[model samples]
Target: MDAYTQPRGKPHVHLVVGGGGLKVTDQAGAEKFGDLPWKTDLDWIRERSEVTVSRLAELFGVTRKAFYGWVEGANPRKGGSQVRIAALRAVLATLPSDLHRTAFFGLVDVNFTGDASFREVFQGPVDDASYQDRLNAKLAEINPEIESTVKRLHRASPSSRAFESEYPSA
Candidate 1:
């Protein structure tokens, strides 16, 4: 396992298993919230979440203009909004790329109890490690099939073309 803190003075620690995947952990805890890695690819997030920029901005509690600026290369202010974006990205990264936007948003908007959805619950200042742990637990309870499918996808070749090229006779 190759473990190291994120770059640009970000406080999160990442463990990269050799020839495998990355695992992000909050090594510095809540004290490091100010230094959490908020810089991420906005385009990727937009594509993955499949939501309009306005809705995305609303989700992070920011204005459309501000979100657009961030998408266009401006750095978002370091604070709760950025933390929420980070949290959303963390959750999205766990899901499959091909999942329908409706299903994805449905998961996000499903009521946790009577009054709170995953979106409402994961907002504001959050402890990264605890949040990820809880998210994993919730996902497991909500849809075990998604987990199994993710595992299967990870084990299989991502490119159908690669498979076809390799087995031309089939």
Candidate 2:
């Protein structure tokens, strides 16, 4: 089974258990038994565990800002099947005892993994001066406020005045 840990304020682990059905045993009793019904759907959360911030936020009905808050795991994740609950518990066992919101999901390059760029490859090594220059320009071009201010001055709020003047001249 493979496991992964998310990178955030607190960090959480995603565990992949294999080769056996969900098992449960009371701490007082030594005997093991099959998982109870009603926790089956949690398997989906396990299968698709270890997602990125935006992805997790969308999948788990959490706002992006809410995900950023450093609080106890607030997402109402009740168990649908004991198997999934067991799986979740097993995964939780590997994580820090403190399960905060930020710790619940971390950066895993989770959503965008493929070659997102339209071009075939980067023009140069990431650290090179040319690459840095291109990266800076690209970032500026993609920034919403910067782009709006530059190409579409019309989109600027009527109340917004130029920095140099009380009112910006067209």
Instruction: Write one digit per residue (lDDT tens) for candidate 2, span 1-170.
Output: 33454444532323222223222334422221112222233333434454455654443344655433211122233322223233333433443323221233332122222533311112223343354344334333334333333334444526534664965668
TM-score of each candidate structure, all chains considered together: 0.52, 0.19
Ten residues in sequence with the least summed lDDT for candidate 2: 29-38
Off by over 4 Å in 1: 1-39, 144-170
Query: Considering every candidate listed, which one attains the maximal lDDT?
Result: 1
lDDT of 2: 0.34
Output the number of the TM-score-best candidate: 1
lDDT of 1 at 93: 79
Candidate 1 structure quality by residue, lDDT tens digits, 37-75: 553546668866657877777767778877776664445
Q: lDDT for each of the candidates?
A: 0.59, 0.34
lDDT of 1: 0.59
Q: Model 2 off-target regions past 4 Å?
A: 1-80, 99-102, 106-109, 112-170
